[model samples]
Target: MDTADAIIVGAGHNGLVAANLLADAGWDVLVLEATPHAGGAVRSGHVTAPGYLSDLFSAFYPLGYASPVIKRLGLGEHGLSWRHAPDVLCHLLPDGRSVTMNRDIEVTAASVEEFAPGDGERWKNAYRDWQDVATPMLDVITSPFPPVRAGLGLAARLRVSGGLRLARRLLLSARELGSELFRGEGAKLLLAGNALHTDLSPEEAGGAVYGWLLAMLGQQAGWPVPVGGAQRLTDALVSRLVSRGGRIVYGVRAERVLVARGRAMGVRSAGGTDWRARRAVLADVPAPSLYLDLVGARHLPPRLVEDLAHFRWDGSTIKIDWALSGPVPWKNPAVGRAGTVHLGADLNGLTRYAAELACGELPTEPFLLAGQMTTADPSRSPDGTESLWAYSHLPFRTAWDAEPVARQAERMEDVLERAAPGFRQLVVARHVAGPADLEREDPSLVGGTVGGGSQAAFQQLFLRPIPGLGRADTPVDRLFLAGSSAHPGGGVHGAPGANAARAAIARDRALTGDLYASAIRAAHRAVYADR
Candidate 1:
């Protein structure tokens, strides 16, 4: 039996973040990854062709650059560099017109002004609102739920009435917010398309916040990619962890979490090896997998097990990566300079696309979230060539057979060709990943759902991964859920893991004195009662 102070069940970015922090605190931490590599969804490789590095899963890094946790970790010092394109994003319309988001607020607003005369000023005002609440808002979203200090600070900044207005906006759907705030299709489409980055539709409540926050973040900090490849980010994290005296073992699957007396003791691997954890066990797997599979249902309460059965997963996805011989040859050449492109005619087109997805039908005119990897980071491919990838949400559990998968990839290329006259001609080689393929590659991305679970209003905050206090603490003692399924649901930002580390450290300190442990236990029971 091997022993350590803390054992992390996965080596995803979030899990690695926890390992780094815990190890830095002078605790011996060990990370076990079922896969042969470290990054779960953040890995990169030449799947398409030689000299072309395509991100296997996640690519853009607007949230990552804005993350305070990444700043604190000083990942840049460990050799993580960011590269941004001339434009952050571009949305191409049916009439060949487009709206581009630039890092400069004035430039982005000007793009909106092309569609609606006075919308430029409106766009600026919205950005100004974002500036006013940016710090406190980030604090609120990334911190533990019921973020008292951050909430109070934001409220003070906005005053009573302004704060109320902000809350109401958060509650509105992306469609409602766009209709209420803008007079033209350009601004509305931008927000709605951004909202679709998650599984949420334009009409889904709480969808407006995702759009508003991501758009603003793009304006403040252009959507960036790692300079070399997405793998560099993972490599930097691994380097930092190793420097701090942490160990990571790949190709080791955690079979079960060992529990005794209702507390997690360690984990037993599929290889018949037991790794003991004297302090804590942090699981970066899905909520259902953690509660029902790893820690058997026999250990869980009846009510909790029932709730886990009802846990909703987000929609599936289909991703296509291409090694292009040349640039995307858009009718509007300006689109070529953008790192990301949203392909939808307008808000109406997006609405119809979402409706098709909701009805479990493959969308004919599917909306795409496409990325030009070489544009963002030239090192991703040879000069004058491009590495491109796009993904679209599909109905949950959609059957993906070989023939249908090939047709779907063709449909995606056709859609791109419609916007960029000769997009298909530029494809030298292509790699397609359907929902089943995605799941086979990364189990954390269950059903090809990227955002962990759905980010709908009902599943957010304290209600995420199952209702309770929105902290990372689980029902079992010394076991913490540190994955994206926890609060602050999904992104490359490592807040969930950091929060889990904080909870574990707090619990460890409290247990040193029996009186402190009693108080902590009582408080936890009160908050989690019947939840």
Candidate 2:
């Protein structure tokens, strides 16, 4: 039996982060990965062609770039180099006009001004608010639930930043926030498009939070990609972990979490091999997989088992990767400079697309979020060629066959073609991954819902992954939930894993370890008491 101080059940970025943090603290850490590779969704490959690299799941890293949690890791020392496009993002309208987000606030302001006079000042004003609260806001989002310290800082800043007003705006739907903030479609489209980066729709409540956060982050720090591919980010985390004496065993699936007397003791792999974790076991899988599958429903509190049944997942995704023979022939050259592009006709078109998905109808006009990898990082493809990919969402658990999935991919291509004429003709090779394919590659992406779980208001903050303290602590002692299913759900940011690592570290401390463990146990008991 293999033994370590901590056993992390997944080699995803989150698990790697937990291992790294623990190893940094001089703890023996072991990571178990079901797949042969390390990255789960944060992976890239030559899927389209030998020379063209494609990000298999997530591509751009705006959150990763903005996240102080990830920032503290200092991944740059581990062969991680970030590359950005000329512009951050471009939202191309059906008529070929594009709204580009640039790192320069003035440039982005000027772009929005083209749609409506005085909008530039308004854009600048919004960015100013972002600058004011950006630090504390991010801290609040990334820190373990209740972010006591960060919350106080945010509150102090919010008083001057229009406390109630800013709070109201954050809870507003993307459409409502856009309508109230910007007078024209350009800024509105930018906000709404950014909101769609999550599973949220234009009209969904609380959509503005992500919309504002991401759009502002784009202006603050351009969406960057690993110099070579998305895998480089994972490689850096793995490298940092190994440097700190962490070990990862790939191709081993964690079948069960061994709990002795309500305390996590070890993990049993699919091959019936038991690996002992002397201190804790952190699961980087989804909530349901961790609680119900690995830990077993029988061991969980009845309420938690019941809550797991209602866990909501974000929308399923259908992604298409293309090895382009040449650059996308965009109708507007400005669109070509952007690493990420939002494809939609207008706000109304986006609403309709969202509505169709909400109604379980296959959208005739899908809203596409696309990436031009070569433009962002030249190493992704040949000199003259472009490595591109686009993705659109479907209603969660939507029934579909291969034929419709193919049609869906074509629809996505059609969306791209409208913005860039002859787009399909530039395709040297193509690869498609339906919901099943994504889940097959990474089971944590349940049904291909990329955000781990839904980002709905009811499931956010303390309510994430079922009602709790929003910390990484589980009902079972010494077992932590260290994935996107935890607080601040979803994104490339390593908060979930970092939180778990912090919790594990706090519980193992000599002076306050008992107190920390007792407090966490009490908190978990209260949270699960009425689940």
* lDDT, model 2, position 15: 92
Q: Which residue pairs in candidate 2 collide?
A: none
| Residues forming the 10-long window of minimal summed lDDT in candidate 1 | 511-520
lDDT of 1 by residue, 94-134 (tens): 78889999998888889999888989999988989899999
C-alpha-based local distance difference test score of model 1 = 0.88
Q: Count the backbone clashes (under 3 Å) in each candidate.
A: 0, 0
Predicted structure 2: lDDT: 0.90
lDDT of 2 at 272: 100
User: Each candidate: what lDDT?
Assistant: 0.88, 0.90
Position 216, candidate 2: lDDT? 93
* 364-477 per-residue lDDT for model 2 (tens digits): 999889999999999999999999998999988834578878889888887887777898888889999998999889888888789989898989988999987778988888
